[model samples]
Target: MKLKFGFEEFILVFSISMFFFGYMRIKFTFMVIKVTDYYLYSYGNKGLLYCSLGLIALFTYFIIKYISKNVNTTR
Candidate 1:
């Protein structure tokens, strides 16, 4: 099947992919840090890790999307 899509479609897909990969990588790194910290603490608390990673991911995604939008806006 051959479906034609404009350049905007490609940019949108690329942006979404970047955001997803960024979030997953950040979340995975955060989990690893939590596990190591837990080992050292023995009685660890991981309450804010999720929130912290989520915020980071969100901010990063927004920044990336904004840049992509602006850089390609002229197109």
Candidate 2:
């Protein structure tokens, strides 16, 4: 027997992975902030926080765009 993998499966896996990745990033940012006393006190911590936020925004945009495109194509 052979198993088939397609775009939908890829998107499902990608979305789940990104979710966990984003969650861990945010958690790590909080941990850093706590250790550093605040986000403003260090450039490295601030950069890490911003980078994670940017990644989250990008992920959201891509996921929405993909879903919208698929929805339009299906109709």
Candidate with maximal TM-score: 2
The per-model lDDT (C-alpha) reads: 0.56, 0.62
Name the lDDT of candidate 2: 0.62
Per-residue lDDT value at 47 in model 2: 51
Q: Which portions of model 2 miss their true places by more than 4 Å?
A: 1-41
lDDT of 2 at 6: 71
Off by over 4 Å in 1: 1-3, 34-75
Error of 2 at 71 (Å): 0.7
Q: Please, what are the lDDT tens digits per residue for candidate 2 over residues 1-69? A: 677887655655665665556566666655664464454345445555555655665677678778989
TM-score of 1: 0.40
- Candidate 2 clashes between residue pairs 3 or more apart in a chain or in different chains: none
Per-model TM-score versus the true fold: 0.40, 0.44
Instruction: Write the residue-wise lDDT of candidate 1 on 43-69 in tens digits.
Output: 222323444544565566677778999
Superposed on all Cα atoms, the candidates' RMSDs to the truth, in angstroms, are: 8.5, 6.0
Global CA lDDT computed for model 1: 0.56
